[model samples]
Every structure is written in C-alpha cells, then in structure tokens.
Target: MNLFATFEERVAQALRNLQQAGDLPGDLDISRAVVEPPRDPAHGDLATNAAMVLAKPAGTNPRALAEKIAADLASDPRIVAAEVAGPGFINLRLDPAIYRDMLRAVILLGEEYGRGTGQDTRPVNVEYVSANPTGPMHVGHGRGAVFGDALCALLAFAGHDVSREYYINDAGAQVDVLARSAFLRYREALGEEIGEIPEGLYPGDYLVGVGQQLAQTYGPGLHDHTEAEWLPVVRDAAIEAMMAMIRDDLAALDIRHDVFFSERSLMAGGTDAVAATIADLRARDLIYEGRLPRPKGAPDEDWEDREQTLFRATEFGDDVDRPLLKSDGSYTYFAADIAYHRSKFERGFPVMIDVWGADHGGYVKRMQAAVKAITRGEGALDVKLCQMVRLLRDGEQVKMSKRSGEFVTLREVVDEVGSDAVRFMMLYRKNDAPLDFDLVKVREQSKDNPVFYVQYAHARCHSVARQAAEAFPQADLSPENLATRAAASQTAIDPAELELLRRIAQYPRIVEAAAKAHEPHRIAFFVHEIASLLHQFWAKGKDSTHLRFVNQSDEESSLERLALAYAIRCVIASGLRILGVAAPDEMR
Candidate 1:
C-alpha cells in the first residue's frame, strides 16, 4: 500500500543482486538508503540516495555507483527510466500504469485507504487540556485539546493502541479558592446580603450555579457549621459541578478523554503516593536535601536560604535541582506530578506526552528530569506547549480579560462556528507558535478558510459521483461492487488521473513522517496539498470536455473517471477524519 516502501524494497533487492554478482562490494551497509518523492515534482516521480549512501562503504565514487544502480533499476518493468542525478541521487520515472493501479487501491480501500502498520507494536497515551477545574476552558485550552485529540486519532489510524487522558488538578489550592467562592454564593442563595467578592477570591458567575445547587441540596440547614465541618463537603460539591461544566464544554468541541485522572486520588488514603515515589527515587540517589539558588531573571518573594527536600534534576539536564516539598511541609506541585508520571509508567506505557500552555515552557525540563529519575531513563515524556491565541473580529481584536471573567469560553466558540471549524482552525498552526483566530475570516465560504476548501473538495467529488450515476445507469456504485470494478480497470491512467493518484500514494508517507516528528501541523499542510490537486484537476475539466467525469457518449469511460474521483474523495475523507474535521458531502 506504501508505494515509496515498495520502491525502496525493489532498489535494495537490486543492490543485493549486484553484490552477489561481484559488481559491487559485498560488505557495504545499505540501511540508510531511502526512496522519497523529489522536492520538485518536475524532477521525477521518485528519487533515491542508494548510491550516495553506499559510496564510502562500497569504496566507489557516488556518480559511478549511481549509474550502476540506475542500470539495475531500469531492468524492472515498473521503472521506465532511472537516471543518475546530482552526485548520487537516482531519479526514477515509473510506468504510468503503476500509478493507475494505486488509484484502484484507493477505490477498493475507501476511507481505510492509507491506514498504516508501523504503530501496531506500541501503546501511546496523549494527555492534554488538563486545565484546572476552577473555571470554564478558554481559547488557549482549545488548541491543546484539538492537538491531543487529533494526535490520538492519527496514531489510532496508524494502528497504535492510543488513549486520550486528562489530568484533573482537583487537589490543589485553586479548588479551595473555588469552594470559598461557592460558599459565598451558597450564603447568597440562602438570601444573605453578601457583598462583592474579596481580593483573593474567584469572582465569576459560573460559581452561581454551584451555589444554587448547594442551596437546593442543603437549604438553610447547613449555615451554622464551622469551616472545618463544611469545607470538604462543599469542596467536593463545587468540584463535581465545575467538572460537569468542563465536560460539557469539551463535548461541544467533539473532544473526549478515555481517562480523567484526579490528583487528589494519589494521596486520598493513608499512604502518600508522592512520598512513595520520592522514596523510590531516593533509593536510587536521585533525591537530596538542598537549597536552590535564586532564579536568574526573577526571584520568589518568600524564597529564603534554607535547606529543603529536592529532586536531583540537574543529572538529567535541568538548570537546577527542583523542590519536592514546600515550606509548609506539604508536597509541591512538582512532587504530585512525579507521582502521576510514575503511575503512568507502572501502567506500562513506554511513551507519554503532556500538552501544556506556553507559560509552562520552563517546567518541561524539570518534568522530563523527574520522569528520567523515576524510570531510570527507561520511560519517555514529551511536553508540547501551545502558545497564546489572539482572537479577532472583522480585523479588530475581540477583547476579553481572563482576570475579569469576561473571556469567551471554548464552548462559545464551537457554538458560534462549529466543531469542524474550531478543530481545523486550531490545528492549522504549529503548537509552539502563537495563533491569530479571526472569527470573521474562518466563517467565510472562500478558499481563505482551509476547512471549507478541503470540505468543498469532498463535496465536489460526491457531486461527481451523483452526476456519474445519472450518466451511467448500468455502472454499480455501491461498496460491494467496488472490488470488482477496481479489478477491471487496474491499469487505466491519464495525466491528470496519475497526478491525483500520486497524491493518494503519498498519504502513508506523510502520516509516518508527521508521527515521527511529533508535528500534527504537517497533516494540515498535506490536506491542503491534496485539496489543491483535486481543485486543479476539477478545473481542468472545465477547459477540456474530454477530461470531464460525465461523458454523455461513452458510459465506460465516464464510469472509469468517476471511479478515480471516488478514490480521491475517499483519500480526502480519511485525511480529514484523522484531523478531527468533518468531510461534508455538501457545502450548504
């Protein structure tokens, strides 16, 4: 199914044949030899660096080795010509029938056309959008949620056992602030004349719902209790309410996590798991008591020269040892995170990823260092930081202040545009770069919005299929008939037809490269490329009637072209699905 892989295998077999015939050195290593598409499409269909990679090992000049490999490759029926290019790269021009056969593969496979097998051996966990349960999710969390969910889908499509996770920071001080805020609302719900919220408390209308719920449950009967008796009761109530709101918000954006890990659960029982994890690292001499020097740029106000429990993060490339416990003898946030990661490693996932906001960029090295110390460098942790999002409306800023509780939530954005538009626009940029999301621009029907452009391509293909059915009443267009039809026209290809097939053939390679680089933005770019090709091919039909899909005179030729269009539509749908975007059958 991977044309590039197939071509590389053929080239390797040819090289081995040469060695067996004593035409080349027998001791050369060709593992690095690879075949890929040429950067410039006009150069060739595919290019390889077999000779260049083997030159020094085989004790031969690159150009000489390239010419030898070219002669050997030209012997194959699929290869029309193999020419030696600059230095030792071999540019390959394949028989057009090979591309035609690939189009048939697409038609036969449909939405499953480009699914891969390399990821079948491992399990991956992608944890993201773990924004605190204190408030509704904002635009920043939207990007992380989309990226992590799309990454999970991509890995799953590529055959990995993928799990989407969200870590709930319910055990932190922020939730206590939330509880006190809700308590005030609870008093107000009891008809007390509570004044404006104090300086250090949460002031948002969201807690009004939680307060109302508390009022419905307890009424005025719970007002006489002390903070000690009522804090835990209302804290749990407030967290549940806030989490319910968060889940609804995520649901609006079409994101769902398989696991929701609670930080409070790690220390709920008599056994403190954070202490247990630190003890495990201490046994390995990774934990020590030390005093951290003041940070280079800014110093903490309460920082004093005193000995404290710390993790030896410097051994794993961190700037300094990180504090494990705070001044009050309570575990720091970093300590809780260490236990969380240990729990992940114990669950047997060799690879783990945490999607965080860009403000947490400085925390990456320390978290990585902690993972290394816990797993003794046996586990992997990658932190993906999503930069800020600037919202604009009609080219003017859509202003909102996080401090004022006036910012638009993720749910509102999804409700305005749609889940498809929100997911596509969020992933249209690299994770580390700041993004400008224009509310006015993304809703447009023009090509400026990539979501509409790609979806329009899918819709056009469906339109072609509908028109073809009317033109060729005898052709079977159902999935059950696709196999027989694919077998019938396996070797039929035109110039424009071959171009569309080439894009389909590149799908698996793009998936593998993007997965390896941990870059989901590549998926957006690839979708754009395929959409461009489909649009160009569609436009060509307007100028040349012979290239059109619905030929009134020849039923067979029209069916064949419809089959090709169907294949392109299948590829577009599969790619769009992986990106968590919908491939609509109609634009309106």
Candidate 2:
C-alpha cells in the first residue's frame, strides 16, 4: 500500500465532507493538493497542503480550513493526531500499527511490492541510444544507453507498455566513410600495400575484421569493379559488421533493443516516407517554400540565401521554421526524424520519448513541434538529454582506447569494472548533469561506492537471515511466518528502525514519481539512501546488544527483525533490477 496515496484519499474525503457541510465550496479543484512525508520527521509522519491549495478557491482562510481538515482527519483511528502547522499545512501522526501493517505488506508482496497494478498501460515508444553504426560505442553513448534502459524498466514497472527502440543512422555520410575505410583494409588483406588510412576515413582497427570477411568472400573480385559498383557492396558489408560489433558492446552491459529502425528504410522500398511526411504537412498549410536568413555565425560567402521547402515549426512552438530538404533536393536529417516519429504515431504510440546526447539539446524543440503537427496535437514527445561522462582514475583523466583510438569504448569500461558498477554510476547523477566516473573510486569495496554499498546491503540482509536460521534451527523462518509474527508482535520502538520503515514505504511513491518525471536517477539516489540507513542500523547493533537483528535468546524478536531485513532486501533487489544491476547475495 502507498501510505502517501492512502492519506491523499483521506484528505480528499475530508474535503468532500467539508463541501457537504457548506464550510467550503463544492467545486474547489483538489488536483493540486498533495500528501507527502513532512520535511522534519519530528513534525509528523505525513503532511499535506490541501488547505493551502483550496483556501483561495473556497474563499476561506488557509489556517481555518487547515484546522477544519485536521479535525476531520483526527476522527480516524488510523491517524492518531493531525495538527495545523506553519501557514496552512497539516501534519499527521499515524498510529504505529499503520507502519507495522505496511511492513507486513512489504513482506507479502516481496519483489513486486512497489510495482504499479494495471492503473495505466498506455503504449509508449522510447527511442534511445541511436548511435551511429560506424564505430564502437563510447562511454558517452553508454550513459544514454543505461539511462534509457533504466527509464524503460521504470516505466514498465509503473504499468506502461514500453517499446525500446534504436534508430540506425546507416544512410548517412559517415557510413560511406566507414565503407571506404574497410575497403582500404580489404585491399591490404589481399596483399595490396595500402599506405596510411586517408584523412576523413575511420582509422580504427575494428573495421579490419569486416575487411577480412570481404576478402574471404570475394577476394580480388571487388578490386576490379568501379568505385560506384564496389561502394554499395562494401558499405552494406561494413554496416552489417559494425552493427554486430555495436550489438556485442551493448550486450556486455545487458542492453537489448526491441527494434532497430533504419533511417535508410524510410526512403527505401520506393516509399519515400520523408517526402510523404512533408506532403502531409504541406496539405495542412504547415509547409511552405521560404528563404531562411543567414545563420548567426555563418560567413556571408558560406551562407546560402535561397528559397527552400520549410516546415512551419514556429506554429507549434519551435523557435524558427525548419527546412525539410537540402539545397541538393535531398531530405534533411530533421525531415527523416519527423518521418520516423510520424511512423511511431501511425503505429499507435501517442506518447513518445527520445533519449539523446548533450549535443542534440538544440534539436528537441523542432522534433517536438514536428510530433505535434504530425499527430495534430494528439501526441506528446519528451526528449531527455544526457550530459557527457568524464572518465577518471585516481583524480587523473584516463587516456583514450587503443582500439577505437578516439575515446574509451563502453565495452572496455564494462570489462574493467564490471557492468554493475558502470550501470549504477551512470545513473548516480541526473541525466542533464555532468557525471565524473572515477575508475578507481567505483571499484572500491567501501561505502564510498554506491553500487558496492547497495549490493552489500542485500548481502548483509542474507547474512542476517543465515544467522537467524542458525540461531533458531527448528523455528519457522520463512518470510510469511516472520511477517505474521512481526505483525502480531509489538511495534518497533526504536526511532532508527521506524525511520528505515518510513523510507521503505516510500518506494512505490518514488517509482511512480520517477516514472512520471522520466528521471531514473531518482531511483539510484533512493536505493543509496536505503543502503546507508541499513548500514547505519547494522553498525548500531555492534554497540547495543538489545538492537541486534538475530538475538540468540529471543526467537520472537529475531523473527521480527528478520522480517524487516527481508523487506529491505526485496526493495533493494527490485530497485537494482530496474537499474539493470545485480543485487548479489554476497559481494565476492
């Protein structure tokens, strides 16, 4: 049960009672009213701003309304005390039995405790990690991959039908360069002494495998063909090989996409989806032939002031109209993107989310505008931009990868520290905030590393269970029996234990909030908080004999604490699953 949501319903019922008694207006909008934990724990167990939100609409004094609401809430036995605090907030003190019941609920639900229950199953299309298929994925791409995967898991946990997608940038100029680079390697494989890799071509050794494959399949045959004849044959082979390598890199982190939509597919098969999208916009008067003014930093000679086909993006909240075609009459990248999103809308996904890199921040508004136009305002698009990750080792900047020769490959980092550390650290910070990933720090076994700490919390829970089992060999120590015993026994009187229970109860609320905000980092922060609390409680047990979890003399008290430990373990494990990190039973 969500304590906050339960209390929110109680507040709403109190407001309805006030409306019936004619003390408040019947038509007041209570949508903005919220119930949450009080900022200061000493104030109360729960707090609400119902009075502050509804006072103006009801034409009543906030304090007076708060007093009325408090009185109504105090009538329920579940709420021990409700008092008006500060200007108009209501702080509620719940009976201890409520928390005990919440703990019981956690035990009974297990790993499914915080998951949403079929409330909203809207089809959402999440497109992320659409990195170019020209090279190995770097650490920057890894950030977006983890963030997107975690966000998808968060949404799915919150009852959304999520489809993970990756848009392949295969039809671009970069892939042509990759083709030429591989062709040079193919000639070298055939004993043609091709010198240094020419400028503007990929120099990475990763493409050497593709060259070997081509040489084995059709050795010396491609050498006799014209540039035009060999270009397509080599480009297709190179793209297939690079994508295989990219998939392998992503697999190391346990990331898998449901769909890999190709940009080339939009114009292939004689459909010209980009042209069709532009025509649809033109019919709606959203497209026109217009000339754009010179860009802010463009030189006069370089700037082309000519009439072009443009989308009226400003009509839907973009800063300026966007061009649909280039000067060479080819579809612009934005046009292809618009078509891709239109396809998403056509496939019945009204809610779309795009995870992009930092450099693509400027592209968000136009793409959102295109979605609005394509769906006729029926669709919503949210773009999450992930900032770059700065790799460091012992406060020193790490060098580039020798394989890619440009940046640190995602596979290299994952191989060095393991996927759990990489995934957890990638989400330790907000997506838009810069993150410093210290190689030395994340590997440390101390509490300094969040992944280790959280995983260790799970391990510690198991250790407690093992100790409890050894102490009471014949007792029923299953989760159900322990929960029943704990529910029947006296409530925990320690302030620290109660605080941990309160944090555990907030998991469902956190999951829902993070899902709605498209911020998976909040989950990372919350699990870390739970880990810190668990570690502090364990440390406390060393000094106080009565606070120990597995008491040898009292099986009843040991069962109660074991139940609590199991609850903590379940929460941490569930959270780690969402983050694509493993919650090990032991660190080693």
List, residue by residue over 223-319, the lDDT tens digit for candidate 2. Answer: 9999899999999999998899889999999999999999999999888888899889999999998887776764533235889888899999987
Worst 10 residues of 1 by lDDT: 483-492
* Model 1 lDDT per residue over 1-588, tens place: 789989999999989988998878788787789999987777779999999888888888999989989999999999999999899899999987776567667777789877878644767878999989988888888999999888888878777788799999999889998889899999999889899888788787888878889999999766899988888899999999889988999998788999999999899878788989988989988888878787667885334578988788899988788888888899889999999999998888768988999998878998998888888788889898999999888789877744337687887778888898888888889999999998888899998898899899899989988897887677787754654555566444667767777778898888888776677778888887788888888788899887887788877677777777788788889888999898988889
lDDT of each: 0.85, 0.91
- TM for every model, in the order presented, reads 0.95, 0.98
Candidate 2 clashing pairs? none
Q: How many residue pairs clash in each candidate?
A: 0, 0
Q: What ranges in model 2 sit over 4 Å off?
A: 297-303
Cα error, residue 292 of model 2, in Å, equals 1.4
Q: What's the lDDT for candidate 1?
A: 0.85
> Relative to the unseen true structure, what is the C-alpha lDDT of residue 89 in candidate 2, on a scale of 0 to 100?
97
